[model samples]
Target chain A: MKILIIGAGGMVGRKLTVKLQGAGALNGQPITALTLADIFAPEVPQGGIKTTSVAADLSRDGAAEELLAERPDVIFHLAAIVSGEAEANFEKGYRINLDGTRLLFEAIRQAGQVEHYYPKLVFTSSIAVFGEPLPAVIPDTQVLTPLTSYGTQKAIGELLLADYSRRGVFDGIGIRLPTIAVRPGAPNKAASGFFSGIIREPLAGLEAILPVAETVRHWFASPRAAVGFLIHAAELNTATLGQRRSLSMPGLSATVGEQIEALERAAGLDAVALIRREPDAKIIEMVAGWPKDFDSQRATDLGFVGDSDIDEIIRIHIADELKGKIGRGAA
Target chain B: MKILIIGAGGMVGRKLTVKLQGAGALNGQPITALTLADIFAPEVPQGGIKTTSVAADLSRDGAAEELLAERPDVIFHLAAIVSGEAEANFEKGYRINLDGTRLLFEAIRQAGQVEHYYPKLVFTSSIAVFGEPLPAVIPDTQVLTPLTSYGTQKAIGELLLADYSRRGVFDGIGIRLPTIAVRPGAPNKAASGFFSGIIREPLAGLEAILPVAETVRHWFASPRAAVGFLIHAAELNTATLGQRRSLSMPGLSATVGEQIEALERAAGLDAVALIRREPDAKIIEMVAGWPKDFDSQRATDLGFVGDSDIDEIIRIHIADELKGKIGRGAA
Candidate 1:
């Protein structure tokens, strides 16, 4: 088997690369070659498989063609301009998120016209596709009414993915991933950053600001689970998916209080005490429009698994990022 | 008020142009200038308002920019490659439907950057955006799972329209029109053509094939009602639409049997007898996937109206196209 992972420099992409390297195979087929691509050349993982790293901007003309020249058996498209960046820069957002994705799909179709070539394409969508007036528990059949440009671009990508798959250009699947909690990095400017920061910072014995009230709830999956979704999507029988190529992946829904409770369970009261109650009204207003929970029935029925609760999500982060160790101060 | 109609040569477009001319005003603003653009130059309507007819293909570079140079106050975008053509000619469909629409929106945004200019954009979408596994009555919140390239394109357009409108680039509204029943002129190759053909051809004392069973139901609005929907959309206060800019227009849901009964009531049994019972398996399979009905609550609440029944649809066609007279044999 051959594999291509776009955005391989990102955290989830890097973890996915490592997982693939350790497994040495996918769907029971041995991995002979792997290509990791991003805006910057990604790190080459240590493995028996032949690995190549390429730096390419997909929005540029002919860039997608260059990447597809090798015709990898499975393509994992994980690259995107994050929500904040996309909303801040309109032209750049549409260029990178919308035009870039379409260009990639078009390149794949053009490549197939030369010869018989069809690869399994796994695309990463986002929960941002759902916006205000959301039901308490979003069902699989809810309409897409994205409030942000990033969400609109992802929705458009989902539509394109379905159409292209139906036309037999390639076998495609789109998985709408939840916000990754306990993200293994420093806090950023994202409005949803607090979801991870509150848990991640306290685990490291540092104080983190709680932007919203404890009652605020949102959907989440750990980085490990997100990677698992991409792999599962690639391995699944598309015949069952039918014409609807996109699906909301299974996730755990938790309130801020529940997340704090899980943190206390994991690292004792000291960790929980580290969270500062500094509410930001801007974030509160923004978070109000976000989806609180999802049924995710279709994804669960399809065998895609999620973290059991916030506790499991935190545990996964500790095991994966912290080598199963808490900060000395918190310990 | 200055008005621009992109598909001024088509049936509904022509009707809308005539209606605008007769009214001499929209939303209490006097009509000062009108521009009609299409693949071919549209006929200049006879009216007191100054009218310009231009031949242009929007997919080409500079075409949309040229159209937007004058910045018409109300822009009615009713242009698209019909479903059958879009399905058969893939590249042409995306080129004209998707790319063309995006370029136009981009042009409007660019114009706004140069000066203070924002137009009320009324986009004509289609029921084709809905597909199989449909509910008995598709509600306002039904997820778009388009089964055709055309529907995929329209769904993408709706997403773009909403995002752009939310960003203040344009005041936009997308109306998802049902199949226009009793469509004037000769029968065409569209899969849904028989819905109109059975009524149209028979009224003209000619045999029209009924390609599906009588029980097969579908949503509909007449050409006159479609024009009304467009005008109402143009004049509507879009604040109520919120961020969800697209709507399924009010349409009557009727089966072929009801249509025949309505025709018999209009022009006696002779008109109903002219309908031939020839079931084309290809069309039957195609019709099976279409939407049977729509709730259309949002559109109705917004004051968009439709023909009351199949009887009203036939009556409007006869009043509008047949000079208020039936064929000699039917009469």
Candidate 2:
């Protein structure tokens, strides 16, 4: 099987590449070739498959078309500007997230003009698509009323994915991933970043700030689970999806206190004590608008899986990113 | 108040334009100038306000920007290709319905760069935005999953309108109009034309074909009600809309049997006999996917009204289109 992974330089993309390398195949088919693309070229992974890495900005004219020239069997479109950056720069967000996705879809359609080439396109949408005045638990049928530019862009992408799939341009599946917990990276300025930082930093025997109340809840999935979702989405039966090509993926809903308790279970009191409560009203206000939990019936029924709870999410991070080891300060 | 009406040549547009002209002002403000634009130039109505008529295609590059050059205080963006035409021609649909709307909003935003100009933009969306596997009574929070390309375009327009409105580029309100019953014009090939035709033809003492089962249900509003929605949307306190700028306008839901019964009550059995039952499987399948009813709480609370029932809808047609006259065979 041939594969193309866009935004392959990002954390998830790198992890996905490593996972794919370890598997040596997808959907029981050998990975003969791989094309990895991003704004910054990704490093070639340790794999026997023939790999081509290129730096390309998809929002640029003809960039998407050029990327589709090879026409891989499966396409993983993970490229997008982060929420904070997108909110900061409106035009840049729409250009990269909205226009870029459209261009890619158009390019794929145009490529099939001479011959039938319908690749399985897996798109990464976000839970940001749901916003304020939200239900306590958003159902699969909840309307998308994104309040931020980034959310709006992702919602548009989801709509386009469904339409293009319906038109037979490509077999598309959009997975609305929850906030990835225990993110294996340095803490960022994003309001939601604290969800992961509070857990990740403490586990590393480092101090972390908790911006919101301990009772504040959010939907989460581990990076390992996210990669699994990507693979499953690519392999799932498209016929069952019908008209709704995009779906909210299943996730574990947990409060900040639950997350801390989970960290304590894995790393004991020493790691939990590193967390400091430093309330920031701005972050709290922003996070409050986010969807707390979801009844992602479709994704769950379709065989997609996520971590069971906050404890499982924390364990996955340690297993995957920390080599099954804890910090020296662990109790 | 300077007002601009795009698609002024269409039936609803003409009605709205004439209504505005008759009102002499909007929101108690005097109409100083009116700009009417469409592919075919609309005739200027007899009014004291200065009227400019132009034949302009909004999809054409620079057309939207040029229209905004005048900087009208109020804009009624009612331009669109019909469903059948859009379904048959994919490129035309996206270009006219989606790209045209985007270009118009972008032009308005860019204009604000030089000088602050936020016009009250009343965008005419359609019930086509909702599609198959629909709820018995679609609520205000129903997810937009349009089965047709036309519906997809309109749904996309709603998203853009909300985003643009949120950014303070334009004070925009998108009203998702139900299928306008008793459309006063020549019979067209549109799938939904028969809904209007059955009433229009029988009222005019002509034979009309009922292409679906008597039990076929759909949401509807009169052309007059549609015009009212535009005016009300234009004059509404937009601050109340908050983040959700687009709304599902209130409409009466009635089956074909209910419509025929209402017709029989207004006119005699002779007028009802003018209706010929000739089932078209294609139209039946198409109509089956349409929304049956809606719990348009947002629109109702916002003061956008529609006919109370099928009987009231027929009365609207009589008072507005027929000048309160009925056929000689009336009961």
Candidate 3:
């Protein structure tokens, strides 16, 4: 099975690449070749499988067509402008997030017109699709009224995915991934970054600012789980999805308090104490509008799994990123 | 106030234009000018107000920019490829419905960048945004899982409207109009045309085919009421909409049997007898997936009204289109 992973330079994409290399196969078929494409050429993973990396701006005319020329059997589309950048620069956001995705879909359809080619398309959507006035536990059927431009783009992508899939252009599936917690990287400018930073920094014996109240809850999944979702989506019998191509992937819901509690349980009081209480009103206000939890029944029923709790999420991070050892100060 | 109607040649657009002419004002401001644009040059309405009719395909380059050069204060975007056409020709549908709408919004944003220009954009969405597995009474919060390309385009438009509105690019409102019953003029090829045909053709002393069973209920509003919704949307203090700009507009929910019964009451058994039970399997299957009813609480609270029942719907058509007279066969 040949595969194409767009946005393969990102952390989740890199991790997914490694996982695929380790498995050597997907959907019970051997991984013959892999093409990794992103804004900057993605790093080619060390594997027996043939790998090619290309740097392409998909929104540019003919870029998507060039990528689809080889006709990869499964395509995982995860590239998107982050929420902050999209909100700050409207044109760029729509260009990359919305136009880019549409161009890719159009490319696939055009390719099919020349030859009978239909591939499995797994698109990564986001919970940002749901806006304020959200119910405590958002059902799978929640209306998509994204407050941010990024969210709007993702919602539009979901619509396009469904329509294209229905028309038999591609066997498409959109998985609305929850925020990845304990993200295996340094802190970033995203308002949701604190969710990961509080754990990642503290585990490294560095002080991490807690931007919101402990009572504030949000949905989460480890990066490992997110990659799993992409793979699972690709392998699924799409006939079961019917007309609605998107599914809100199952997630572990936890508050800052619960996350801290899990940290204490794993790495002792030293790690918990490393979390500095410097609340930022801006993040608090923004986080207030974010989805707290979801009843992702459809994804769960379809066999998509999530971390059992905050403890399991942290454990996975340690085993994967920290190599099963605590930082010196925390230890 | 300057007003622009993008689909002034269509039935609802024409009605809205006439209504504006009758009122001579909107939001209590005196009408200064009107611009009517469509695929073909719309026939200029007879009115004291200055009017410009333009032939334009909005999806083409520079078309939207040309339309926005004057920056009309209120823009009613009522243009779209109907469902049947959109389904048959995917490229045309996306090009016209999706790309055209986006280009218009982009033009408005560009104009605002040059100088302050935030128009009240009243977009006409459709009940097609909601698909099968629908509730008997679809709530205001129903998920937009459009089953057709047209619905997908409209749903995408709603997302864009909300996001752009939230960003202060434009004061936008998307009204999801129900099936417009008793649609004036000859019957068209739309799957939902039978809903109007049973009432319209019979009132004209012509036989009309009922392609679906009488038990099949559906949401509706008259063409007059649809125009009213547009005007009301244009005048609304959109602050009440918050992050959610799109609304399921208030509409009457009635079955085929109820419609025929109302026809009998309005024009006796002779009019009801003109309805023929000729169920086309294709139309029946298509109609089965349509939204039946709506709990349009938000639209109602926002003061958007609809015809009270099938009787009022038929009455409005007679008063508006038939010169308040039943056909000779029924009279």
Candidate 4:
């Protein structure tokens, strides 16, 4: 199987590359080659499979066509500007997120006219697609009323994926991933960054700030689970998806208090005590409009698995990022 | 008020032009100029209002920019390839429907950067945005699961409109029009043509074919009501809309049986007898998947109005089209 990963420079993309290299195969198909592309050239992973990394902008005129010159059997579309960046830079967001995705789809469609080719396209959507006035448990069939430009772009991508799949141009599946908990990176300035910082900083024997209330709830999954969703989505029979090609992946719903409790269980009371209460009204208001939980029965029935609880998510992070070593003392 | 109608040659566009010319103003602002554009130059309506007609394809490079050079105070974007045509010609559909709309928005945005300019962008959407497995009465928040490519394009347009409006690029109001009943002119080969044909052809002393069962239900609004929706959308204070700028207009939801009954009451049973039942499996299956009714309380509360019942709808069409004249018998 030949695979192409767009946006292979980002965190999830890098993890996905390593996972594919380790497995050496996908969906029981022997991997033959891999092509990775990003705005900056992605690193070619060391593997027996033939690997090629290219610096490409999919949004540019005729760029998608050039990238599709060596058509791959499976394509993972994960490239996007983060929510905060996209919100700040409106023109750049639409240029890359919206126009770029459309250009790729159009390129694939045009390629088929010259030679018939239909690849399994796996797209990463986000929970941001759903906004305020939401039900207690947002159903899989809930409408997309995104209040942000980033969410609007993702929602539009999902719509395009479904339409392109329905038209027999390509087999596409979109998975709306939950926020990655215990994110293995330094804390950023994003409003939701605190969700991960509160866990990661404490685990690394450092102090972390809690911007929102302890009762504030949100959905989560491990970075490992996120990669799992990509693999499963690629392997699944899209015929089951019918016209609605996008699925909300199952995730663990937990409050900030629950997350800290899990962090203490994973490390110790010393780690939990490192968390500092520094409330920010801006972050709280932004987080309040977000969906806290979802009835992702459709995704669960379709065989996409997630972590059992917040505790499980933290343990996976520790094992994967910390080499199973737990620091006991606070900084 | 200076006005620009992007699809002035279309049936609704032509009607809108005449209506605006007759009023000589919009929102109590006297019309200074009018610009009409389409693939072919629109007919210049006779009025004291200064008018310019241009042949323009909005999807082409620089076409939208050219249209916006004048910077009309209000833009009525009604251009689109009809559903059947769009379904048959996929590329053309996205080119004109999707790319065309985006270019227009982008042009407006760029124009603003040069000098401050924000027009009231009233976009015409359709009921096709909602599709199968629908509720008994689709609520305001029902998901957009479009069954057709045309519907998908319209849904995407709605998203763009909301985003652009939210960003303060333009003051956009999207009105999802119901199927226009008593569509003026020759019998076209569209599947939904029968809905208007059964009434239009029969009233004009000709036999009209009904390809679906009379029990089939769908939404409706007269051309006059459609124009009213546009004018109201233009005049209303958009601040109340918040982030959700697109609205499902209040429309009459009635079954074919109800429509026929209303026709019989208006022009006697002879007019109803002219209706020929020659069921086409293709059309029946297509019509079956459509939305039956909607709880459009949102639109109603917003002060947009439509015909109260099927009977009233037919009367409006007769009064508007036939000058209150009804043929006594069939040809």
List the TM values for chain B, per candidate.
0.98, 0.97, 0.98, 0.97
Off by over 4 Å in 1: A328-331, B328-331
Q: What is candidate 1's lDDT per residue for B1-331, written digit by digit as tens?
A: 8999999999999999999999999999999999999999999878888999999899999999999878899999999999999999999999999999999999999999999999999999999999998899999899998999999999999999999999999999999999999898988999999999999988888889999999999999999999999999999999999998999999999999999999999989998899989989999998999999999989999999898888899999898988888884432
Ten contiguous residues with the weakest lDDT in model 4 chain A: A322-331
For candidate 2, the TM-score is 0.97
**DockQ each:** 0.93, 0.78, 0.92, 0.77
The parts of candidate 4 lying over 4 Å away from their true place are A328-331, B328-331
Clashing pairs in 2: none
TM-score of each: 0.99, 0.97, 0.99, 0.96
What DockQ does candidate 4 score? Answer: 0.77
Question: In candidate 3 chain A, where is summed lDDT lowest over 10 consecutive residues?
Answer: A322-331
lDDT of 1 by residue, A1-331 (tens): 9999998999989999999999999999999989999999999978878999999999999999999988999999999999999999999999989999999999999999999989999999999999988889998788999999999999999999999999999999999999999888889999999999999998988889998999999999999999999999999999999888999999999999999999999999999999999989999999999999999989999999998989899999899888888974432
lDDT of 4 by residue, B1-331 (tens): 7899999999899989999999999999999999999999999989888999999999999999999988999999999998999999998999999999999999999999999999999999998998898897988788898988999999999999988998889999999999999787788988889999898777877789999998999999888889999999999899888788888889888889989998888878888999999999999999988888888898888889887787777777777777777663321
True contacts kept of 4: 0.71
For B274-311, candidate 3 gives per-residue lDDT tens digits of: 89899799998998889999999889999998888888
Candidate 1 residue B124 C-alpha distance from true site, Å: 0.7
Ranked by DockQ, the better of candidates 2 and 3 is: 3
Better of 1 and 4 by lDDT: 1
* After superposition, candidate 3 runs with Cα above 4 Å error: A328-331, B328-331
